[model samples]
Target chain A: MGIEPGRLQFSWISSAESTKFVEVVTQVTNAIRALGPNPDFTKKLAEVA
Target chain B: MLSYAEKIREIAGRLLASGAVNMVIGFRQGTIPMMNEPHFAKNPAEAAKLVWDSHCGINLANYLTDRKEKIGIVAKGCDSRNIVTHIIENKIKREQLVVIGVPCQGMVDKRKIALKCPGEITAVIETETQVTATGNGFSQSFDKKDVLQHNCSLCIHRNPVIHDELVAAPVEEQKGIDRYADVRAVEAMSPEQRWKYFEDLLSPCVRCYACRNACPLCYCPTCFVDESRPQWVGKGQDPSDVRTFHFLRAYHCAGRCTDCGSCERSCPVGINMRVFTKKLEKDCLDLFGWEAGLSLDVRPPLDVYRPSDPNDFIK
Candidate 1:
């Protein structure tokens, strides 16, 4: 439940609204790029492996 | 005005004697004060041992999981709600149960009382109005309304939603209660402050799964903590492991927890684990306008998805 908000995104777009969907995806991609990878999950994954 | 103990025994005994049910799940007097054991009455004679009081905080629905026997179970508002959850989840059948509902006032917080009176609590006596805690050298009494479990005080449903028979007329449901004040207080904090708040809050955990074991909703055949294949949670006293366990446990109960307060009650170190579950409960209510175990017909929020369901935070 402590999942960082930046790591996840949700938006509603109809099939007709392809441009809106692309815009949302681009915004999310840029935001996540700025934030970088989720260290907590990556560290946990490494420990598990 | 409710004489629950006598009524429960009478109803349970009748159910057993009539051969309507093979077992009656209820509470027996506990070995110590402020604790009651979840018990199974196999015969009319054993049904005589069934009692109800402020101490019967353990959810008896935990015993109903995968039980094949026709059961007559004593259920408070929260317990009845959990039974509905169980029925919806296919943990048990509605036809297999005869719910003996009790209109709850509230269960007392023994820890609060213990803090008020500093000694071994030898005996605790409760009435509708007050609770008296007695020890060797001291006797303290407090208003019943003042010491109820946080969940119980703000409970919207004080009457069983589904029951075959009631021990008494349904108690008035609590109205206009601010159920999420503590949650709101935490929400007001900065993200870093909140992270620190929870870390400090869970610092006392010894990784004992008493909270998980006590919850009726947590009847997973193999809990994630026990999974060895790509083990999800470490079974150590490390603070991160403890936090992970708490986080996942609360998440698992997202749409199904009835805010019964058993998890908090069962904790040895008195951690308020309800903080985690209540946040989920509030979110479900806000997002879906749903409360757990209110009806058998409706699926839990996470169990079913609609095309129109909100996804505003998603890309």
Candidate 2:
């Protein structure tokens, strides 16, 4: 319940605003990257290797 | 509280005798103290079995979903709210229900009383302002205010929002109560600390779906937890799975929960899961100026979209 807001983002972009959509995507990715990995609610998948 | 039972029985009997409704849904005295069972009265004879007391904490609206018969339901404040939600959602038609509204004081927290008593409680007696618990070796009386269910104590709506008949004059509603103090306390904590607090709070969960079953809002035919084709969550009691289940369920109730405390009351392990829903309730009030199910004419905030709606979270 305490997950950072950046982890889930919602945006509205028209087809005409492709550049704005790209810019917003970059902003969201960077915000999530800064928070790093969440320690809770993430399943530890088995390694393929 | 004692006279309420007599009045409820009288109203239910009249409804049944008049053929106003096919069934009258109310509470009957439970075998054990502090537990009341939902009773369905089809005839006047069965209506006579109906009772009302502090232990009638379960919401009567939970039984009304998609029901086709004309039902006369005993509704307290929270139950009436849920019934309103049900009508708005098209789960049932408003014409099919005859709501007999009850002016509720509050329901007692049995778990709280159980903790205070030294022995098993054999009987519980309630008056206008006091509750007495008698048992094998202990007899204790408590001020009703001290033992009220946490949600009930902070409840703002003690009178039904809508009804066809009144059991008694509407009780004065609670006012100027800080309903979201606990939610604010959780918000004040750091993310890690908040996570730890919830993890500890939910650790005792055993994956039982009692909370979902008790909720009037959770009328989904196939809840996320039960969907196997996509498998939204695991069936076992894994910590992460448990968190996902609780969080997702809380999300499902976002704009619709009445804080009736049925989920907490039905929990076998006594987990206060209202922590999750109450936060969303506060947010709905703060962001959308919405308190759920107070009106039949207005739609819920999340159910409709407007250009002026808040979009600060969106990039």
The candidate maximizing DockQ is 2
Candidate 2's residue-wise lDDT over B1-315, tens digit each?
A: 578889889999999999999999999989999999999999999999999989999998999999999999999999999999999999999999999999999999999999999999999988889999999988999999999999999999989999999989989999999999999999999877888998899999998999999999999888999899999898887788999999999999999999999999999999999999999999999989999999999999997876778875442
Q: State the RMSD for candidate 1.
A: 3.5
Count residue pairs with overlapping backbones in model 2.
0
lDDT of 2 at B120: 95
B234-288 per-residue lDDT for model 1 (tens digits) = 8877666788899999999999999999999999999999999999999999999
DockQ score, prediction 2: 0.65
lDDT value, residue B59 of candidate 1? 87
What's the C-alpha lDDT at position B210 in model 2?
97
User: Across residues A1-49, which tens digit of lDDT does each residue of candidate 1 receive?
Assistant: 3445677886778999999988999999999998776654332433553
The alpha-carbon lDDT assigned to residue A15 of candidate 2 equals: 93
